[model samples]
Target: MSPSTPQRPRTSRRTLLTALAATPLLSALGTGTARATAAGDVYASNTDLYTRLPDGEGTDYARRYRRHEMADASTEARFPFHRTTVLAPHGGGIEAGTSELCLAIAGYHPATLERAQADGPVHDYWMFEGIRNADNRELHVTSRHCDDRVALALAAGSLNVLSLHGCTAAQAGAPASRPEAVVVGGRNTDFRRHLHEELRAAGFRTVDGAEVPDLGGDDPDNICNRTLLGKGGQLELTTELRQGMFGSFTRQGRAKSTNDTFRRFTAACRAAITRLEAGPDQAVL
Candidate 1:
């Protein structure tokens, strides 16, 4: 039998209500009262940006997600429900290669939007992308402040979350001589270790996020850590690393062209998730 409509068995009514109530207040404050990051972001939260921007999806911005259904009684004996989720809050032009990486890490092909492997595991995913002509950086909503209802609900319902982000080599404190690197952060120590090991094994440079004070994703409120286990992992890829993953680093190019580096990185991430899922920490969501 085919899978039924996606179920959100873990998103409680209280959680939805709390998210709905908090979003509008932030949006209503407008840009004036919104806290500006060191990068000079104007919006307080995703709700603030969504309220101010034109309602033009597929043009200015887009939101996409997928939550696979649980197996029925007949299939449950053979298949297990995926408890992990991958996220890209600053995808498309905002962070370049993150959107593509998010899809690939969640078991989909970035170019074709199909399952990367026929019998491979497919985890849940959610991405908010900026498809604008220019100035997409203004759309960024930091992870701690990301209040998109769907993103929140999806995260709340999952046991693990793997959030993807892009950062400058300078921000990551990578040596100028060799700048291609990824910083692994978030509150989940086991998840972070797995990611670091897998990425290093795949020939990618990995850094401890604690070395960069600002990028340390240890905040309990950060979206990636707001999972069923109340902890998750975050990967911050440097610009050099992200750019090398695509042949032409434009919005259109990212969707159609991904090189070997991209494949290797995604494969490493999936391997880490698989390790986490099979480990003893696989909490019931």
Candidate 2:
């Protein structure tokens, strides 16, 4: 996958939503002039995403934590890098995005939407939503700290459209597309790999590669906050483009309070995990 527009390509949640809400005529605007837009971090290209400190900005907060770093490769779609950041001792643990981790796997992730299309037909988009109540450390076997996401979006795709993640404090009031399924992703490789396995066992499909394809249209569903990331050994989700899911810049205006981070639904997550860990066709709905 060649790099998208040498410059920083943006995919704002607010902008897309605003456009979608404001310009209802795009779908019928055949030229796609209003909608045939392109997204950055396109299906895995050369890119770098870093995590932020919990206390939010400044050197003091910066001193408290560091971004998890590994390697960089904007390779393919299943692994669309959205550039994630976090605060506190939270979002850490060998995870990508949240704690300051780099591309978790080595080299370019070797899956392409085009290749997948060649292998088989690419079709509809499948979205998933979940919450990571535990911190990267807690989930990945570390003993330091924990974190909570009022909401979390996971990556999983079938033919054409890969999953999209509008999950975060930034996306709080932003317009977001609803997902088809929701699966949690943890910090460690083993944990994530295990989770993927469990999801499959529960009858949900996951892409073997890390790429999410772009189904062109007025919507042009490309990956956004597309995949889970690792930072300073911590984990967090990221978007495909810095462009907001809500149209405004990620750090724009007074930050909106994030929705309830999964604390109230601990039982639900545990139950979901248990079900996946335990049975064959337990149903993940």
Candidate 3:
């Protein structure tokens, strides 16, 4: 993985959000622009920057709580490496369901990365790294820590990536009845449509451009859209659906056990990916 970028550090929550909302479009418009730095130890540049730290709370808690050690690939093997990448940026503890989904979808794919806890809990993105995969390459891990490496692997080529993230229904202003909805985003039209269709066919609701215009994945720098090939897909699964998949509401890294919903959902995702790889002539939907 490549080294992290150095730039201006963030001052406050408002400033951080403002930078996030503005940087993508600005990056898309300009060929070469200035980079933004993150506040404190963490450098916020791409898709892996979010946490429970409130406005006033300092990074002390995050610093003291998280253990920043790269995993030993040989001991803690997860998935092999392939051209297709599956990532759970907010895995470990930042987001509850992401790591599980990423691993479930990865199945036997050699190119999958998830943040797993070694000793204690870890929400720090900069510290996350992957074991050496089938390709014998370790992921640079955090975008802030190793943007260049990740860029080369996923963002710089024609690689297809599937990113799983966790979102709240209340945050999206979704109706109570649609708690099992998975909001589809990213620039890959075919993959996005397949995700929506597969999720719906698996008995889950979907919210896309028609319902949530703001989360339409138009931003070029978004981790999902940052694929080297051109575009990729992002799935923001709701808390309810995640809970159904894991059969609990814990913030643990991986599920100790899983439910039928999890199996069905993963199967649907795999089937969609299979069809996607089969080319347009073999598209199931």
Candidate of highest lDDT: 1
**How does candidate 3 fare on TM-score?**
0.60
Q: Rank by TM-score, descending?
A: 1, 3, 2
10 residues in a row with least lDDT, candidate 1: 27-36
TM per model?
0.84, 0.21, 0.60
lDDT (C-alpha) at residue 216 in model 3: 55
Residues 252-282 of candidate 1 have per-residue lDDT tens digits of 7776889999999999999999999887878
| lDDT (tens digit, per residue) of candidate 3 on 1-285 | 233433443446676566556633211101111121232223343333222112212321111111124444686555322335566654434445556666667662112334332331221111122212111011112222334344345444435667665556754447897766777877788888888888789887788844664445556665656665568777767667777776554433236657788878877777667656555432222
Candidate 2 or 1, higher lDDT: 1
lDDT (tens digit, per residue) of candidate 2 on 1-285? 344323332446665456445532211101111111222111111121112222222321222212223354656524322222222121221121221111111111112112222332112221111113222211121111111221122222111111212222122221255222222322223333544565445443333222221111112122322223220111123232112212322222101311122211212222233332343322223
Candidate 1 to truth, TM:
0.84
Query: What is candidate 3's CA lDDT for residue 238?
Result: 66
| lDDT on C-alpha atoms for all candidate structures | 0.80, 0.23, 0.50
